[model samples]
Target chain A: MHSEKELIDGCAKGDRAAQRAFYERYCGRMMALCNRYAKSTQEAEDILQEGFIKIFGSIASFRKEAKLTTWMTRIMINTALNMQRQKLYLLPMVDVNDANLYEQEEIGLSDFHFTELIRMVQSLPDGCRIIFNLFAIEGYGHKEIADMLNISEGTSKSQYNRAKSLLQAKLKAEQKYENVRGQKL
Target chain B: MKTSEDRNFEEEWKSALDGAEMAPSDHVWNSIDLKISHAEQGEMKKRVLFYQRVAAASILFALCLGAAGWFWNYEDASVKSLASQTVGENQKESASSIAKVPFSNQNSSNSSAVTITESQNANSIKSAVGNYENGVKTRIENGGKNHALASEASNGSDIAAMIAPADKNVLTLGKEAELESRRTSQSNTGFENGSVTELATNGLSMSAIRLTGKPVEQIESARTFKIAKKEQSPTDDQNRNWWASVNGSGGAYNQSSSSNSVATSLFQQSATSTFYAAPNSKEVGVGTSFSYGMSMGKKVANRWVVMGGVNYLNQSIDYQTNIVLQDASQSKAFLADLASLSSNLASTNPYVLRNTNEFISVPLQAGYLLLNRKAGVQLNAGVAADIFYRNTMTDLSGQFGSFSQAAGDNSVYRNLNWTGLLGTELSYKMNRHYQVSLMPGFRYSFNSVLKSSTGSTINPLVWDVGFRLKYVF
Candidate 1:
């Protein structure tokens, strides 16, 4: 039940108990954050392991200027981004013209499982999914995402728009299918 | 300044995933734990290595100083004993010459009256004295030039002239006959009287020998004695005080176990990574090392030398680590996909890593002569403070070409370390000024050359055989 400051001090000194306590305390949220950026459970686990390793390695540099959770979240996100970059370097980029044309229509937001929503986000293309997560969930602007991903601001915006349109289309289709199933019942 | 529709969509997504949680498999923590534990162990190893180096350096420095001091005191005592022996020998020669003159004068004056008896007596005295003089001359020749004894021998003629009058009664016929019989009997008994007399002279010289009572000529002769001694044994001459040597050595350098294990772990980790297609096969060959240095030594004693100087060594190692690519067809599709994203993925061949390092060291060495002859051997040991000069890595292209560079920055290696050396030199004396030697030795480092954080704690154990050419002054 030590405070965040005490845990950080202990972790810096490489106290095993303190490290385990710290990991258990923040791992759920961090894993969820990693999950948002990864396409599968295994990839998310990989990112999670890499992120915690970094946190423990650099805990001495954590001056507690920001909240511990905020600092850890930033580390997790960076780890996921690096993992994406490595994977992206090996894969071909999809043509921009292949993005599905869709209308910007309002979609039902209720009655969707949280896991289903995560699935929808994960289903987006690799480049579009990262931009979408950084912009929509991580609260980063298009300019920041562009700098982070080494792309133009316009590309970041276009990628975000494509991800949003695709998610909207999928959500709408799922909601209509659920309604049709209810009518048959 | 976000658009309304964009703001709504972001809010919807955020709320939808607000409490979403997925616990990773238990093995994720295990993997993290393993990495952290390895890093901690590495840190501990570094600290231990550093302390070991300090202790080793301190012990080596103290030992060199202690040996030099001990040998210096011993040499001083030997020189004093030898000087005392020379003074005693000089006194004996003086007495013997004085006794001989009277006998000679008596024999010449009374030749007709006691010709038969005196001739017999003369023969006896001359035989005994000649034997003693011949023995003394042989000792002087074999013991090298002794200026004190040579000067005293010359002064014997003067002593004989001074003591001639006081010895008249002792030189009478009856007493002379008795003295001859006694000298003859003693000579017959194997020079026992002569030996006793020599011992008495040694005691007297030790107590009463005074350079102050001597004339200026005698003092000048004593000075010349030292010059003659130096000329006789030029190798042992204290006046020739400087020596220089050039040596070159080659040996095999071995890495420590801890470092090798850590490197293996890292290689395994890389092999398991998704980027690499196959497991790495690492072969570490015997590393070839070469070193040469020029050092100047001072002869501190007859059998001791102390030297301090700089040395430079370049060590290179060739370790082939096969970065086997996956099946060509499977990798082709992957490479084509990778090519569109980054043009740097042009080649996919296994590469070899060649590591080279250079070092400069300042060594303070102490040597003791175990044997001194035409063929001799000596033992030497010292401590060296070594500074790392450079480390270079060359990736020779494999079947395809070189892949992305994976080596860490060379600047991360530790710049300074200390090593302990123990070696023996087998030497052949060519002349008074030049000698050649073969020095075989081993050097052990007490600290790692690379930083611990790099997880590479390479400490080299090197065995060297060197050829040396030396000049002594």
Candidate 2:
């Protein structure tokens, strides 16, 4: 496990070994994580490249208390979400009054992986996907989501509910579509 | 701790992402290594060239200065080698002393039994002279047994034959001392080097390199002494050393000149003659020592010689011409007596002595005796040069036949001559090395005129002084 300091100093010196070592160890996990936050495969790959560049460039600031891989994964996620936000697309933010629209249905074991499930959740409209990822998967409360996204607490909770309701209906609708096609029962 | 919840979700997402795989291509690392090597190579080359240049310059400077000083020592070694060669003859004399020993008559007993060691001791001292006298008195009493070694004292006369220009009395004393020292040392425990080993001899023979340094050291020490006394606070030890050096360099300078005449006005019949008598040939071209020097040989050899000096001299040229006076005079000339001619010049101070000075030299030398017969003398030559600074306007005032001071044409006073010298020297070790000798010599400059138009003459000569230091080498 090479540290961020050694990797950074080595990279500045154009050390190929240090660069290759860092890439081989963490690239795979960061790319998958990028896919969840990005709108398309191209967008996800772009985020992975850009985040790694930023990581190497600003590596001097790293205090090294956290694992290097964990630090890298967060950078990748931030890069993808920020790129999507900069596109200025309207987010499907939910109202706090729309809480009843969410359904707490139990999930069944399926051939699809949790990685696939996370990707599906990220495919929601922009605002809903961010709220859904932060509140449900990332476990931030409404107040933290509000502070992080620069929105009101009411708006954050409302957006989180709308995201949950949208994922539930999409899952139900995808199930029905499969049932009608009869490719699987 | 609140971030713990976010971290948990991050971990879950990470686990979900674990199945994905993507690796960086190898090109990035290859690019970095290539860039670094190029930068390092450039820096290393620059550093190496810088160090190489510094090393080369430092080596060159050291070699140049070292070679110049080394050349001076080469000259000294030649003189020493010649002096050492004189010892070979003493060994032959030693053998002859042994041959004279052994005849049976009671009167001849001591002379015939004269051992080599006793003869070596008796060779130079009063005891040796006395013993030889005793042998002769014995031979006269008994007649004929002590005749062999008498021929070898005749050999002392042989060495004396080669030493001309040397004072005979000093030469005799030096020879006797050398023979005595050899005889005494041989009579005592057979000490090394074959000469009577005096304790002082150990300190006397330093080396040539040390002798050459005396001039520079004398200057430095004199300067240091002056500075030591002037300084506000100094150790008593430092002042003591300076005084010791000054005292050790003790010598005196003296000058004398004479002129005789009577029945004079402003001048009379001058004792000094005016005719020029320049040497037809140069004896030797002098060196540019203009400084003192000292040398030291090994303990077995003689040490300590201080010689070499510089002197500055100046003079103006003046002369009379019959052709010029005959051409200018219109009336019948008056007859002049020898005293009147010298005393009342047709013209005096005709040309302004604008400037005149050159080297007037005085050199002091001292040395140690290496062997009783062979001792070294340091020859110090003093430096001098001529300079003419004033002009010839005084001669512009012409002579009054009425013998009155008045102004006239001074343009005839052309070509002022001035002179100077090269203070060069060489050392010699005569048979009796410590016997003091003085062979003062002159170096004359051929330059007769100061400037072509100045009409002044200068006499340039470099003189050397000689002195003896008894070897304690």
Best by lDDT: 1
What tens digits encode model 2's per-residue C-alpha lDDT throughout A1-185?
88766776765554546755666567676766666666666666667767766665555566568776767766776777678666524543445575467444533325347655666766776777777666665567889877766778888777766766666676667666767888754
TM-scores for all candidates: the values are 0.43, 0.29
Error of 1 at A134 (Å): 1.5
lDDT of 1 by residue, B1-473 (tens): 67788799999898888867777787777577656755654564454354445434534544565575566445433333433343333444333321222122333232211000111112222233233311221110111111112112122233322223332111101100111111212343333212211211111121111112111222321211111111124466732478888878776655552434433443455543333321112224345577888888886887787887778886655444333323434322111111222322223333334456788878888887765667656678898888888765444221232223122353545788798988777778898888898776778888987666644566777766777888887
Cα misplacement distance, residue B151 of candidate 1 (Å): 20
Collision count for each candidate, in order: 1, 74
Candidate that would win on TM-score: 1
Q: For candidate 1, what is the TM-score?
A: 0.43
lDDT string, candidate 2, B378-432, tens digits: 3223332322322221111122221111112322111333322222122233322
Each prediction's whole-model lDDT (CA): 0.58, 0.36
Measured with C-alpha atoms, the lDDT of residue B155 in candidate 1 is: 26
Candidate 1 per-residue lDDT over residues A87-178, each given as its tens digit = 66676334354345546577857789887888888888888889889999989998898889888887787778788889988998888899
